[model samples]
Target: MFTYEISPVFILMEEVVLRKMHSIIGWPEEDGDGIFCPGNNTMSNLYSVLLARFHLFPAVKTHGMSVIPRLALFTSEHSHYSIKKSAAVLGIGSENVIVIRRDERGKMISSELNSSIVAGLVPFYVSATAGTTVCGTFDPLNEIVDICEHHGLWIQNDAQWAALLLRTNQEVIHYHNRLQRAMCCSQGLLQECNQLCAEYLFQPDKHYDVSYDTGDKRIQCGRHIDVFKLAFEAQINHCLENAEYLYYKLKRTDFKLVFKGKVNKVNFFCCVFSNPATQREDVDFLIDEIACLACEL
Candidate 1:
């Protein structure tokens, strides 16, 4: 059982960090909206779907699922299972979530996505994968975007791995801008969808700016201040560099690689380099350990 007491200071810090994140993701500073979630990417995925649902069918918020048609959302087979989990939790039914086929590299095939959009189910959202879970493959965004735009669907880029790339690589900045509605985690639309406006906590007649009271934006009453941790970890380039070093080393070794290329090329192996403290020597040691273990097998 986890709980936290939300404070005004925490809310201010969250807004600052979220705005910085938006800027880094290539959104104009004040254009996008976001909120910090107490859970992981799964929770974030759920929140994104919730926002999309509310965006498309605002009536569902008050009238319940009965008001809406048999709604459907789209995601790749290689995409996170959280999408399906989100569907279930939102009463959309897991079976209703149409799975689009992926290519050999584990990316959502745009043609298949286009073909999948039929008449019966009301397709309102598409959860495009920025970096997939197992293969680390990024779905073709340019193609996906064209289809999403034509179909008039809300696009949510599940860029859980994007922060690392945005910090280390500049080339992706252009590609990121094409994302229409939301990216990564929660969005500003969240406030509209989930705000309860509980009088005691979020009184509008307060002395301070009441909008700073971000806690009411979440379904949870007590939210852990996770934004502080994100703000503190400002150095991530070295971590990516170390991972790249390891990637090359593993390529030269006898170990059978799952995916032979980097993220942009085709696919990437999940070699975590998240810890800022990881060094070249540590990568070397890991490679050596893998080689030794291979010899045993």
Candidate 2:
């Protein structure tokens, strides 16, 4: 029963940001397609699963899950729980979401994933975690992709690293104008899967190009102007530098690395550097305070 109006300006902003995202992912500026969801990555995951379901069984949109065979989805044990949540929300049932094994470094074991695709259930989707939630280890994407290709499963890469990379104001500017040609490939699929073609809002007879009216491509009636906030730019190198500084500082203090060895890339604990305001003095104080608290324990 909820209702909302989509402004022309809001539609323009969405188009700009979607194009920016495509460029960031090294896709053609005008080639790929996507929609900015009112929710976070979890919602996006839901959309991805919904798209996969609809893609494989178009009748599911009109006829429901009863029309299709029992479907199975695969994800790493270390991946976000949203995959199962998506399954449950879509009436696919959480039991159908198969959990793949992860290695010592918390990366998904591709071999285990290949072997996990059991008999009877039609494996339609696989969610690959790029940066895991706990250990922040990246899954072996190439190997996983090969397996998914072999099984003819729809692959969705859950990557949050780009958000971390674009957290700072400096890095945002660095990559701002650097546009390239590549494709998301999923955008069109998403539109095809979810579009209701409501004539009231998405009237093709309108004077302006109706393609920018992307609200129909979503499941919800009210679409928020989420792209408004991303209008500003940010940087990554400065944040990475800050992370490296904290990494060495933490090493010298009472804090022990969760995984021992040389500190190469900044680990998950250095997320504070995402804030551009974080300075060396703050990092020093944090390290000292944590060490002091540890000693008191």
RMSD of 1: 4.1
How do the residues 140-174 of candidate 2 rate in per-residue lDDT, one tens digit apiece? Answer: 87787788888888887776554444433233312
Candidate 2 global lDDT: 0.69
Candidate models: Cα lDDT each: 0.73, 0.69
Tens digits of per-residue lDDT for model 1, 47-107: 8888888988899998999999998899999989999999999999899899998877789
> Which candidate comes out best when scored by lDDT?
1
Candidate maximizing TM-score: 1
Identify the runs in model 2 with alpha carbons over 4 angstroms from their true place. 1-6, 24-26, 29-31, 163-187, 228-239, 261-276
- Stretches of model 1 off by over 4 angstroms after superposition: 1-6, 167-172, 175-188, 232-235, 261-269
Clashing pairs in 1: 33-188
TM-score of each: 0.85, 0.82
Model 1 accuracy (lDDT, Cα): 0.73
